[model samples]
Target: MLPDQSYHIYNHANGSENIFREEENYRFFLHQYEKYLSAVVDTYAFCLMPNHFHLLVGVKEEAELARTFPKFETLEKLVSKQFSNFFSSYTQSFNKVYTRKGSLFIKNFKRKPILTECQWQDTFLYIHLNPIKHGFVKDLRNWKWSSFHGYESAKNPSKLERSYYLNYFDSWQHANYLMNIKKEAIMKEEME
Candidate 1:
């Protein structure tokens, strides 16, 4: 995680245990993330599942980060530290609630750089469509946990970067159409 770079980061549980056991579990995980990384990263979209979660985020600009953390020499290390803290915060709370101990998520979150418009669009769709892909829901719009819901309900108050879609598609409605029309191919590719 470097400054001003967009990445698709995701992680699953260590075993069969779920990372989110209840609705509050999901909200708490998100709250922890916001508390730790809101200033360090620009959140684009996210999806929290039963045993894993995905996030499409971009590191804050280099100049902004440098100003924010004047004591840190390398912004990458600072960004990584924030993420570590976030994971640790969630793990501690989750462990206590479950009445069990040990790692909740697999070590070292998997991340892929979003280098092009195509990759960014793919990642955005991928993250939003995770519930459907995982069989958690048949309709993406009904999944209240995902940022995809933000697109449909303009009144949805969230920290997500909802306007990112406007950069790729003509409007929010068009963005919705693109995502829906491409659903079949996207789901097919995910299966492969």
Candidate 2:
């Protein structure tokens, strides 16, 4: 998670467990994520499914982080620590509420850098369409736990870095057009 780099971060629940059992659970998880990650990264997109979650984020520039945490020796270390704390805090609260114990998430979550325009577009559609791919919904917009709604609505300017990514498409209309094309292609593949 280097500064100014876009990474696709993902993690799954341990075994066959559901990370979120109710709507409130999703809200709580997002709250914790914002509490820990907002200052360190600019959230581009996200999707929270029953057993897993995905986040497209750009790590804040070194200068931005330095201004926020003047004493931090390295931005990478600080960002990593924040992520660790985010998971631990969420897991602890979840355990206490559910009357269960042990790790809720798979050890050492995975992340891949978004190094190209194609990867960026693919990752965005991949995350938004996860519910459909998993048979949880028939349409991407039907899922309430993803940032798809934010992108489509063009609201919540503060939460998602929508403008930054939409710029890649030149306009919201173009972005939606591409999303539909991708969705159709995926659905066509599935039907084959």
Candidate 3:
């Protein structure tokens, strides 16, 4: 895996995509994501498709976000504590509701570092515009499942510093570079 390659993850519904078709499943996923955000992660952006989801998170180097246990004094311990607790809780809830599941996620979470400003911008665009590219909505801002509207419309409060998105270009018009990402990427298996 390259440092800046996007980390894509998925979990099947007992070897099928059927589970994702329900609104309840999406709601569960959102709840779990919020827990992760409130605890282990700083969410810059996200786009939730039907069967899978995408997130761009900045990991804190130290200081755990929440804890039901005694204090953790190391970054490694903090990371492990949050991920394990979050995943376990989600899996239990999912299995109880769905009545089947060996695992709710594929593996230990995968990560890819964003090395340059260009890659960072592209990744953000890719995540934000995903719903649009899939024909889910006519405009990126109309999609309820993504952070594009939040970053672009100021409708959602995200954990990322607003300055990072603003600093990408001289003006939002100049940074409205989202239109340039190839639609062909919609056919790519990892992201689309």
Candidate 4:
């Protein structure tokens, strides 16, 4: 969660429940995410599964955060608080709509630092392919809730930092090819 650092942020629904029950739920969650997180973090990629979601984000520089939230004591605290608010806001609305109570997500979300080039590439692809990996979809592109479509369509300029990641590959096709190769390698290892 440090400034200018890349992290893989993820969380799952509590118990056997699904975080998103319908298509509107997914859209609402994303809308909330953008409203709360867009200023503190630059989203690189994301995927919203039935029970979980993953986000690859780079924490914005302290200076940028200062500009966004001028009264904050620390940039880290500001960013973390915003994320907490994001979750709470979504959960509260979801609970009211479903007439359910208690926590919707685990105590705290998990975040892993992306320290190496390999980990960064792998995490990006991993987020995009999660629906397919979980058997929710056979093709990555068929999954409507993932940033893969954003990257492929190059339409969502406001959300994903697509150009930054695309620079690592020769083309979008090349990126997909490498992602499939990585997926195959992972599946092979899982089988062994």
What TM-score against the true fold does each predicted structure earn? 0.92, 0.95, 0.71, 0.93
Candidate 4 versus the native: TM-score?
Answer: 0.93
The candidate that wins on TM-score is 2
Instruction: Write the number of the candidate with greater lDDT, choosing between 1 and 2.
Output: 2
lDDT of 4 by residue, 1-192 (tens): 688989999999999999999999999999999999999898889999989999999999888888889998888888889899999999999999999999999989999999988888889888987876787866787899988888778865657877778645677888899988877866676578
In model 2, what lDDT does residue 8 have? 98
* Runs off by more than 4 Å, candidate 4: 155-158, 185-192
**Number of clashes recorded per candidate:** 0, 0, 0, 0
Clash count for candidate 1 is 0
Note the residue pairs that clash in candidate 1.
none
lDDT of each: 0.86, 0.89, 0.59, 0.88
Which pairs clash inside model 4? none
Output the worst ten-in-a-row residue range by lDDT, candidate 2.
Answer: 166-175
Q: Which of the two candidates, 2 or 3, achieves a greater TM-score against the reference?
A: 2
Which sections of candidate 1 miss by over 4 Å? Answer: 185-192
* Per-residue lDDT of candidate 1, residues 1-192 (tens digit): 778889999999998989998999989988999999998998888999999899999899999998889999688999989999999999998888778899889999998988998888889888888888777876887787888877777686878777766776788777677778777766677678
Ordered by TM-score, highest first, the candidates read 2, 4, 1, 3
Off by over 4 Å in 3: 1-14, 61-70, 133-135, 155-161, 180-192
